[model samples]
Target: MLKRVEKAQQKWGGSHTVIDNWLNERQELIVLYCKIAGFSPYEKKDQSLPEPSQIQAFCQILMDYLSAGHFEVYDDIAKACEKKGLESQQLANTIYPRISDTTDIALDFNDKYAEVDAEDLLVGFDNDLSVMGEALEARFALEDELIDNLYSNHAD
Candidate 1:
């Protein structure tokens, strides 16, 4: 997951400020996720389920990333597509609904963990995080395709 995000950042990093910011937020989210999951290079000092604060922080970044994509990055893509012609617009149309499905998954994750007390967090956290990770991975791929196809024409 981290490798994929890094690849995306390398591929599209400096194309636009909005994209740069969005991708950076993605990196942050993934790092926190890795830490929480006790993944390689981020093994926790204590093996307990992640602290509520960590979940809250992750959710905050998650919401920010989602908002920036919808309100800023995708808005720019839509505007660019208008100028890029019908094909670009059609590509955006085809991709947008799929991305929204991933968004729904991420939102469900946020609702599940954003404010749960410590005891409540343990019930299905591993499964929930695993699901969230998959949704995030799918979303990143959709986002990369959105940029590669739509923004390629918009490049100056």
Candidate 2:
């Protein structure tokens, strides 16, 4: 996704403020997820960091990453549509913004960890996996619809 954003910037040749904004939105959600999952020093790194080998850290990262990707991509498209005066831009509002998604992630973390002591954060990792899996399902469905629309009126 970062590559795609960079490529878009290179192709367009201007300030990629929209891409930067989108990426920043995702970064915040990831930091929030790290906080809820008991990962320390949840700072966004300048360089790509090594993946945590721990289960809970891995799950939290995966979920937040997926959620962030969703937000950033849709936000970019939304901005594009808005620029073009297209009604489809309004669809972006149908889904929760990045902050809302962050809150949902924190709530999910708290709920799953409520009964368990802080020592067993891994117990809730499966829940995050399930949530992310469902999100992927929904994303694929939307992509399918988008593909259908794109091909539906093609020249014969």
Candidate 3:
């Protein structure tokens, strides 16, 4: 996941302030995810789920990242595509539904994690995180394609 994020940064870095900041936020979310999922290089010695505060913090960042992508980034890109004419608009229309699928997966994760007690999460947390990781990976790929397709001809 971290590797995917790095690859994205390299591909899209310095493209625009909006994209750069979005990528940075993505990296932050990935680091927090790795730490919580016990896959980080600096993984804590303990095996149990992290403290509620830690998970809550991750959830907060997750929600913010999701919100920004949907509200700000996608809106701006869609409008740009509209202006760029039908080819861009068609590509965006095709991609947006797929992206929204990933968004729903992420929102489900956020809803489950952000609302529950730590003790309540113990039964399915690992599975949930695994699914979240996979969804995020798919999301990153789709988002990269969106940026490439929409912004490659010209940076905004």
Candidate 4:
């Protein structure tokens, strides 16, 4: 029993670290988003749409975040659940489709606007940004649910 608990800790400890890093990345993304969207310190009066390069940078980060979740984090959670002999299929079924839907929206947003020059962004870009923001907000909530349902249970 001690060995089993130690192994579970070993498995979950690494995932907990990864989840912490991912959460930090999410915070950074949120700040960058607010900067580009002209909230708080980047007030509307002094704000302009971020440069094309900036958007590209954010898109790269966004892609990294998404990739890490799918390729690393989710796999780790599934493995941990399997190790514990817990049934996570229902959780996966509920969350995976929502996450996939969000991924499609994010990719579409990145493709459409990541390359647009600052000048082009001045014309009707707000609408697209608004949609992206909403999608991201929903996505983040869904992701938090996943963590709570899956990772929190395994936390040492």
**Candidate 2 lDDT by residue in tens digits, 58-150:** 445545545554565455555554554434444435443533454465556545543453445353364574574344345434532322222
- Please, what is the TM-score per model? 0.91, 0.37, 0.88, 0.79
lDDT of each: 0.86, 0.44, 0.83, 0.70
lDDT of 1 by residue, 77-115 (tens): 989988888988898998899999989988999988888
Model 4 steric clash pairs: none
Q: How far is candidate 2 from the true structure (C-alpha RMSD, Å)?
A: 10.0
The residue-by-residue lDDT of candidate 4 on 31-148, one tens digit each, is: 7777677777766774566778767777878788888888987887667656654455567667778888889988987888777776673566678778778878778777666666
- Cα lDDT of candidate 1 equals 0.86
Deviation in angstroms for 74 in model 2?
Answer: 3.7
TM-score of 4: 0.79
Estimate, for each residue in 103-132, the C-alpha lDDT of model 3 and write its tens digit: 898888888778667557467888988998
Predicted structure 3, TM vs. truth:
0.88
Model 3, C-alpha of 77: deviation from truth (Å): 0.9
Note the residue pairs that clash in candidate 2: none
Candidate 3: where are CA atoms >4 Å away? Answer: 44-46, 154-156
User: Ranking under TM-score, best-scoring first?
Assistant: 1, 3, 4, 2
lDDT for 71 (candidate 3): 89
